[model samples]
Target: MYNRKDKQLAQKILTFSCELEEGQNVMLQLVGLNGIGLLRALVEEARAMNANPFIRIEDTEIRRILSETGDKNFWKNQAEADQLPLMKKMDAFVGIRASLNIYEQADVSREANKAYADYFVDPVHFKERVNNTSWVVLRYPSEAFAMNARMPTQRFRDFYYKACLLDYEELAGAMKPLQDRLEQTEHIRLKGEGTDIDFSVEDQTWIPCFGKRNIPDGELFSSPIRSSVNGYISYAPSVYQGKPFDFVKLDVRDGVVVDFDSSNNEALEEILDTDAGARQFGEFSFGLNPVIEEPMHDILFDEKIYGSNHLTLGNDYEIAPNGNESNIHWDLVCIGADVYLDGEKVREGRTFITDDLKGLNPENLMQ
Candidate 1:
């Protein structure tokens, strides 16, 4: 039954997410063990579609070592010679990470990580694959992940499956009204515990993601017009790049981060200083995943916590570009936000109040 569930997920990934067709090339990248079951299933499903499936299994420790030791020229060559060429030949990409240690890269310097992102990640994956290929990235359930979620391994697996197997078609249907409202909205305000922020999404695209881009996905995202964001935000407890953060706060002025603080202030400073765009807002989104109600210290789940809102501090999606580009696209989540769209209160905390958008509230979506 466990492996069967994996097979079902693999089927969904190929058929629904990637939309893999016969003879198309798909590159599946797995970051750790414990996801071999799903990998096998993905291969099987891809072959069933007569699609060519290629696999790349990576070790986190090795990745950390390379990031720590590799230089500018090394990363440039790696991307230009290896990853970028390989990615260009692919029709779709699926990245599955089930790392035994999320903190494996903790000792790697921010400078090194930034170089890798600039030279390798930005050009190869973010620019080429993201804009060209049908791609989806997700974390596979494992004991390490369960520990981070603060749940028993078995219980967390159950939660994972339930969330991932949601009726996304129904959710997508439910999202239309909110999408309509957001598209028409020019100004927006968000208020919650220690959070009061305002931004503009005028003329920006509101992307409703239910199942295609991400598993366990239920969010509508739009990029803030660069230079339109103002005020401050207090994010919920979260983790980024394998480090835990608490009481993260940022004060923005004209879309740029003027002041920021967190449990590790030094780290926050380093991250924001990655590039000019790293200090500006790139994406704003509302979380509507009914099954996910709390933080797991993992952005994949926490950013989709029902009733939550998240903001990204770096690169915007090509589909909804704000012209703020960086090697990073970090998402910071905050719960308990009341949303106002163009001065009209549409959502009071976690519940959508407007008639047209009420279907997106958890109570209705749970049905």
Candidate 2:
């Protein structure tokens, strides 16, 4: 069952993600094996807010097929004819992800993943679908996910729920200083143990976004100039869905990932080698959610961690001031690292100066 707190949390999650407006039609996609209760609660919240809500539950087996079939033509056509229609019809979309098998099988084809990536980069549909929607992707805990996190199932859920309840306004406020700093500097460098990278920003390339009607968890993001990255980046081991990628070290030069090595994961190499644009940098963003604790090895969850951090490679949504090149956007998460714009540390391990921000309603700041 569901308790009042759980229901409240569900509503808050919906509110933060969808921000349903009166009379808008909201569509939610829930992975069938996880978070049905939360989905129901979200429906109720949408109704209460006078918005029409629709819920579609997807089976994990379908995902397995897409990951295994390497069926590009089918998905490419579907994106143009089917998914695009739904995007135009809906006011907003909220995706609730809960996977029963994160790494259902290690034998699945990396080529299939590449095929899907290629399909997304379809020029006509990518512009139409990505640019027109107000959307969000969020996560819920499941037993399989807990196993990957190496925590009890209940503990994982507790951490997830607690993180979701964090103050969005405070989180947004904390990111302002960093955003301002990025606006002032043309080049930013990232340095860490086993990682040293430098990337140049376009003269007028930064995107500054405030909270909008649909996306409540607001943050600033932009695409790095296509050929502006240099040096190496070592991705810490991460588990996606349920599959794990070994530590990956990429040697980037002239805005492209020219050389790459992974401890045990050859699939990453295959991805970067698939296309010219695939290896180039796509998007850069700083996480703003204060409630997100630490690196839990999940990109979706890790990117939302409170404090200031940036992600490069792959562009999905049409972020403001976007480079608008590749349709394949992959988000890489980094945490517990200092973020500097020019020379000042805007984020010292997740804490940002909140006093310098304007239009930040304190009443709405996250606790």
Q: Which candidate comes out best when scored by lDDT?
A: 1
Tell me the TM-score of model 2: 0.83
Across residues 225-302, which tens digit of lDDT does each residue of candidate 1 receive? 889899889998877766678769999999999998899998888888888999997888989889998898788888
- lDDT of all predictions, in order shown? 0.88, 0.62
Off by over 4 Å in 1: none
The per-prediction CA RMSD against the true structure, in angstroms, equals: 1.2, 4.1
